[model samples]
Target: MKNIYILSIGKVYRKSNNLYFIDKDKNKRVIPIEGINAIYIMNKVSLTSNAIQMILNKGVPVHFFKEDSKIGTFYYLGSLLPKQKKPSGKVHIEQVKAYINVEKRSEIALEIVDAIRYNMIKVIEKYREVYDYTKTLRNLDVRKEFEQKMTDWKDATNVIRGIESNIWVIFYEALDKILKTYKLERRTRRPPKNEANTILSFSNALLYATVLNEIYKTHLDPTVGFLHEPYEKGRFSLVLDLAEPFKPIISCRILIWLINQGIVKPEYFKKDLMGVMLNENGKRVVIKEFESRIRETIKIKGKGRKSMLIFIRKQAYNLEKALVEDTKFKAFRLVY
Candidate 1:
């Protein structure tokens, strides 16, 4: 199945049980809903209720985005039980209970942090083979302190957030050494300052929405989370929690596009009151590369040469299994 992206100003509506895209120039195109699993509306687009109904009937989620920032998602209410017909609320109950208990929450936090740490280190090693990352990162004891302080009454989420911040610091520092013209000083949202940050913000949002779509095909509720506080309107925090480990995969691709391949040119970006943003061409380049990267095959322990997208859904299903069976949840680590 493929993802249908409405990237231009258009109106997408259902016609005789099929979806079509009509651009401002009156150029009409038919999108076969049979092979499409999700729709991403990136720009100004009007959707008829008939289109929404058709998407829901097909059980395909519609993700709306304003540029790189995600606005909302529309999917069926009963999309949680991918394999079972009835809703089993047991997994959600276990997830919330684990969040309430400090020890349980700390353990979950450690699992996430460990995965992030391992992948962060791997990314550095993969890019900068000449540098000694272990010696360079020896002074930053964020993970060690994170593990020790997680059990305290202090919020476990905040502790994990702190370690996440440190990991980015080490990550960007190593990245600076690799890249020639671009440098990432700190992470930025809303408006990305530089080219690298611009690509990162845009691609990370893609990853977030992708993971949320995958989570919908599982028994777990996306609203309830362990590392992030579950907000009523912000039900995607759990997807954010699950997105931590897979970041290096996207980050590696972004670096390759920006510095190695030199494919992302200056004209691909634009500056406005919102700082710097990817133009249509830039977004197309990033999305094309990012999608290709996710589809690339990698070896899983038991599952041989699985695509990264398949691994993400498998990880989500594994989390659901952990919640239901009361077993340890392990995040996905890059095979390299």
Candidate 2:
């Protein structure tokens, strides 16, 4: 039910009637402006200040990305940090304790790491024959087996960082898969060669953006993070927090599906002066794949009536409620 108007082409303007108007050929059409949560301006779509103001009044932010897919800026008129309420000392101590609790709560965080790592490993294996990087990592797995290890990870922090290390290896391996899966005599950037990689990255970006958006409304400070550092340009700590729960379950699943279905291959990306880049065609292929992924849903474990999207929104709200009510905060733990 969340509506996102993706403006990849053309321009839009706001009318006096409080409607957004767009031009097609020589005729003007009214774009459905209601129910829109955000507008993504891809390829730097132009718009008037009046249009921007109208959108801000409606509580919809505008996301601008450069032509090369770099994050340009986010235009949300309100201050995300304005008049912030501080958590009481008791509440703050409780949050840290909840995070460190040696119970089901601690296991909840560990589960997220394991799920994400497992899915990343699957992606590498799925495309093992295609990419050299996959082959290298796969070979390393064989060699590392001699080290011998028990599967159980007792410490939650150790479990989380350990899984992340393995996931990074798989991420590079997946990138390699895209490079070798396709066959072309000369690499060209006219269109992206690896549709799978393009789509996966796009999907991750969207996921991260959503996390950051939700964090702004919560009592949890977005800047303070554990795994991802709070940096100057991209202080995306909150996104990292949210992605911890979803990496293996959603991102990894989409990667594996693309490889198995032959939806994307090495031919989808090309090497250029910039190293590797997706062509326009590849971008379209991946965007479509990402759309399909967003639509894919998992049944929420509890509250049988609600879907995953509903579950995610509720989880964000719950964090805020917990903080305001001076209760412990629990992060979402993905079971599958």
Candidate 3:
């Protein structure tokens, strides 16, 4: 199954069980609902009640994004199928229990941090093989710095988060040195400061939604998180947690590839009161590449090969197993 992205102004409606999208220009396109895994609306698109009901009944999630906002709204019907009918309350209970237990929560938080650190190193290594960024990486001493910070880590999630943030600072510094066209001096959002920051914000939003979609298919509660606190209402803290490792592997890598290959250029971005952001065309380009990257297959040792989307789902399942069955949870690691 694939995702359907509506990037232009359109009206979506259902006719005789078929989903169709008609752009403002009256150009109609047939959307195969059965083949759709999700729907992403990146622009102003009106949806008929019938169309919304059909997708909901079909168990398809619709993610909506505003041009100015990175994190948007997610719409879905909750637990429609028999398999999803009774999501194991046992899993939810265990997840909350683990969260309340300081030692267990700390262990999981460290695991997530380790996964993020491991992938950051992998990303640097991959770039070094193709580009002469070794000097920048060495100067940053990412691994050594992270190790030193870890030495002072306590059973506090806030400290773990602090260490994670510091590592990203080093990673971004190396990234700025490697990039020829863009500079990400520091990570800024809610109006990303520059082109690199703009793309990073957009990509991370997409990844958050993708991980949340996968979480819905499992018994894991998206509300409670190990690394991040579940303090904000309506915020999927667990999705934020799972999205950490993937940010380096998926969002950051895609940003690097797009900039270096010249697939995304200055013309793709524009500045407004909302700060620098991808134009309509820019959004389409980024969405196309983001979808392609997630669908791309990679080989795993015992698992043979799997798409990035499958890996995401497996991560959720692994978390469920760890919480409910008391099994060891193995976070997804990028394999060269």
Candidate 4:
């Protein structure tokens, strides 16, 4: 199953038992509902009630993104599987219980932070082979020293977050060195200031949505989280938590690859008062590459070679086991 991205102005509707999309230019495309994992609408598109119902019944999610927005809005039907139907409630209860228990929450948060740190270091190390990032790696060593003092901190969560933030700062420093055209002085969001920040913002947003889709396949609650505080409104904090480690492994790597390979050019972006953002052409190229990368297989211990999407779903299952079964929850790590 693959995700179908609608990057054109179109109307999607159900015809007979099949789904079809007709663009404003009268171009028609058939969408195979059974083979679809999700639908991402990044441009102006309309979905008929019948089409929406069809996708829901097939257990497919629709992710909507506004132009130049960081995150996508999600719409999907709740789980329909008989086994998940009853266990989902129990799993959610266990999830909330783990959150309310301070020790458990702290443990989970620490694991997440460790995963993030490990991945960030791996990314820097990978690029160091081709680029002169000696100063950047030395700065990372200093950050590691601060991370060692984390145990003595009173607020473990806040301290762990600080460590994560500092790692990102150092990682961006490394990126600045590797990128020939773009200078990533600092990480920025809510309208990323430069091309590097724009790519990072867009790529991370896609990762968040991908993680959320995986979470929907499991019994875990998306609103309740470990590393990030759970909120009743806005942000799915749990998605934010799970997406942290993968940001370096997936999004950051993709950004460097796209820019360095000349797959994404300066002409692909536009700068306005709001900030720098990918143009329509840039979005198409990035989304196509992103989808291809996720589907590519990698060798993972015990699991052998598996696609990134499977690993993401496995991570969700790992969290569920940790919460409900009192098993160890290992965050996904990139193999160097």
* Candidate 1 collision pairs: none
lDDT by candidate, in order shown: 0.73, 0.51, 0.78, 0.77
TM-score between candidate 2 and the true structure: 0.63
45, model 4: CA deviation in Å? Answer: 1.7
- Deviating ranges (above 4 Å) for candidate 3: 69-84, 129-155, 232-234
For model 1, how does the per-residue alpha-carbon lDDT over 1-336 read when each residue is reduced to its tens digit? 677777799998999979999999999999888877677777778878887778777777777766432221112122212234457587788888888887777677668777777777766765545266544654556557876876766676788777777776776777777666666666666567677777787778778777888887776788877777686463577888888888876755576456566777889988766567778888888888778877788887667888888888888888888877878888888754
lDDT tens string, model 2, 232-319?
Answer: 3545554576566565446556555566567775665655543455555655665565556555575545645444444556666665
A best-first ranking of the candidates according to their lDDT comes to 3, 4, 1, 2
Which is the winner by TM-score between candidate 3 and candidate 4? 4
Predicted candidate 4 versus true structure: per-residue lDDT over 1-336, tens digit per residue: 788888899999999988999999999999988888778787778879999789878878787766634321223223322123345788999999988876778778877777776777677775645345544444444335445766754566677677667767667777777776776678777778888888877778778878988888888999999889896457888999999888887888888888888777878888877678888887777787788778989997677898988888888899998998876678887763
Stretches off by above 4 angstroms in model 1 are 15-18, 48-50, 68-85, 134-156, 231-235
Candidate 1's error at 113, in angstroms? 1.3
- Candidate 1, position 102, lDDT: 70
Q: Which residue runs of candidate 4 sit more than 4 Å off their true CA positions?
A: 68-87, 129-154
TM-scores of the candidates are: 0.85, 0.63, 0.86, 0.87
- Candidate 4 local Cα displacement, residue 290, angstroms: 0.9
lDDT of 4: 0.77
Candidate number that wins on TM-score, 2 or 4? 4
